[model samples]
Target: MEVELKLLLSPADNDKLLQHPLIAAHARAPVRTQQLSARYFDTPDLHLLRHGAGLRVRKIDGTWMQTMKAGGSVQSGLHRRNEWEGPVDRPWPRLGKLRKLIGDQQQWLDVLAADDLKARLEPLFVVAVERHTWDLDVDGNHIELVLDHGHIERHGRHVPINEVELELKDGDPASLFAFALRLQEQVPLRLSNTNKAERGYMLCRQTGTVPCRAQGLQLAPDATAADARLAILNNCLQHIQRNETAVIEGDDAETLHQMRVGVRRLRSALKLFEAAAPCPPALLEDIVWLGTELGAARDWDVLLASTLAHIQATPGGRSGVLDLQALALKAAHAKRSEAAQALLSQRYTRLLLTMGCWMQQPAPEGLEEPAQDFANRIMKRLHKKLLKRAQRMDESEPASIHRTRIAAKRARYALEFFHSLYGGKALRTYLKTLSSTQEQLGSHNDLVVADRLLRELNQQHDAAAATIQFARGYLQALQTSRTPDLGAIRAALHALRLP
Candidate 1:
């Protein structure tokens, strides 16, 4: 297994990091510099990448080496993955040699030694860089820190690769984050979510990023509560990071929505485990700030798509509300820009790095309970509380119902995190009913937002006064007439069982 934390460095600060005092103070050996030029290979269609694998043959300091990295998870820029590396006699990869190194490991042997695979392999991109490395002893923990600076090239296109990788050699993983935090005091670094191989492929493919949905996680039946918590939180972070790319690289409102959902899911997961696995309240606060930023754009997006379209369908409403539509879209666009900038901000990177560090901490001894038992206890309490709150939706105002909606959403997120610990049929049905209730509440919540937004615009967009008045009146009437899905919410709560 390869355990490393990857960070991006500014080329201008490359020398700054090299001269950082800690690198020398904790150095176990003199820093070594090498010229590394690697040729990455895959099928024309990238079959290896599809299966979560990367293959490369590199010449480092005049010696050729072959390496394969596969099936890794990158969370908050920390990567944990399976790696197989060995010397090769020549510059080209010898598949048969790689298979022999597999040494009867059937899982990867089947992947590396497939018939006709070697023949189909083609060089995809070349990664050329100057790598300077150090073996360090920090508080008795052994680490290998390397700085690689150069570019990835395919055909005539290229992207710079100036990154620092801290690989755990013989110690605790937390030391890597600790050392990184110290280094950041002297030099600014961004936690790199993308590795060299992935970057090389991205350069080769020249593909655009789209919004990524929350990934599903499967917990072992025998897993511990700590295990489930770590897995789910990492999954949530991955969800947010993927959509972060979408928002940063593309112009899709859905990306913000999905990223907001990821934030909310993460918050709920932290609350669910608060008793056992507590996180710093400051971390939670930072996340709430992020959610608020994302929600601004998301609310406008919903108002434009759902409420405005409904008002547009009414008699003469199309011509009446046209100005409001333009105002809403303009507001949405502005908020989207702000949200994207938030992702690029230093505060955001600090939050991710801190959360990633927190994830590295070992679970408290008291919290090391079995997954199923802990899940049932936590879940039953959540279900009962939700049922109690939801039963009052029959008489509550939109404000109170909005509270219930928040509760339902949190409950829904918790249910997803624990889904793998229970049986399929009953949980699936409960989840479907719960989903329906949340969606229905969500639809109603849109009216609340639309009303507030239009009121704000009524104060600002003076040229569209009549249009704003019409839209606000339309949403006001809709909210006044709307009813909560008492039956479905109650049914969802009822269907949720203790097991």
Candidate 2:
């Protein structure tokens, strides 16, 4: 297995990194440059790629090498995967020998060993670059900092590749992220989840982005809090990064919403695992910043779409609703752009790197207990706290209701993290009701925000006053009509049962 962290930056910023003092400060050897070119191969239908594998033959230093990579997890910019590399007589894969490199990976071996697949394999894309590398040891951890400026060209479409790979040859995995965070202060780097092979395929196929949701964390039965914390946090990072491209390139409202969910999930995980999983205060503050940024866009989107539709349905309300809708959509678009740029900014990248580095910390003392036990204690306390908060819910006191809603949300997130560990009909029933209560609270909150937003617009732009007045009246009516049933929610809370 190989561990490495890859970062992307602009070609202009490339020189900024070349002169960064860290390079010379820790260099174990003089910087070396090489001209390299690699040709990726895939069957006509992309058999290997579809089966979670990639084959490439590269020429560097007048030597040819064949490599195969598959089955890896990418968390926040860090890559850990199995890699097999060896000399090849020419720039062509020698399947007979290379297939053996992926030993015990029977499924992958079978795909490569097929004679028909080999016959159909052909160069699909070419990646050519000028690579500069320095060998450095930070705290005794050996790292190869590689800077590649190149492009991947296929069928006349070229995708630029100006990136750095911090390949860890010998060191603790956390050290890699530690070095990355330090280097980030000097260079504006974006943590990349896509590998070169995958990038080539995307460029060649022009594959579109799709929204990503959190995947299941099937923790082992014997896993401890230490193991579970890392797994849960890694899942959150993947969820956030996966939706990143979708939110940027696609306008599907749901796509950006999912990305926001990813952010909230991470914050929730850190709180639930508390002692076992800790993050720097600065990082936590940045996460709160990110959530607010994403929330602004989401709010506008919902107001323009969901909320406006409801206003239109209100039996008898009128006055420039259409005009207000137009303005809301424009604001939503602007907010959406701002949100996308945040994802592309250096500050956002730094947030991920800092969090990733912090995540690598060793398990704190006293967290060595089994995950099941840890989860039981945390959930019990959380459930009790939520019940106490629920008992305070009051229609007259919207503040109290919001507090209860927040408690419900936190409790729900905690339950979700441990759902797989203790699955049963009882757990399902509780979670379903809890979700219902949280959503109900959210609907109430939305009306309150809508009213405030419309009033603000009315104060800012005189031309919008008439329409805003009508909108505010309609919003107030909606709020009055749906008085949140605190009794029902309290009933659900009192019946709380932990799985």
RMSD of each: 2.0, 1.9
| Cα lDDT of model 2 by residue, 372-488, tens digit | 999899888888889999998888878888888888888887788888888889889878978998899989988888877777677777998888888888788889999788898
Give the per-residue lDDT digits (tens) of candidate 1, residues 1-499: 8999998878999999999999999998899998889999999989899888999999866789999988868876689988888899998888877887768778787777566888999999999999999999999999999999999999978898899999999998888888888888888887878889998888877877877898878999999988888888899999898888788767787888899999999888888888867779898889999999999989988888878898888886747587778888899889889998898777787788889888888786656788888888877777777787787774347766777777777777887888887766777777776787778888888888888998899899788888888777877787667766577677757767654
**What's the distance in Å from true for residue 480, model 2?**
1.0
Q: Pick the candidate with the highest TM-score.
A: 2
Alpha carbon deviation, residue 34, candidate 2 (Å) = 2.1
* TM-score to native of every candidate shown: 0.94, 0.95
Query: Each candidate: what lDDT?
Result: 0.84, 0.86
Instruction: Give model 2's clash tally.
Output: 0
RMSD of 2: 1.9
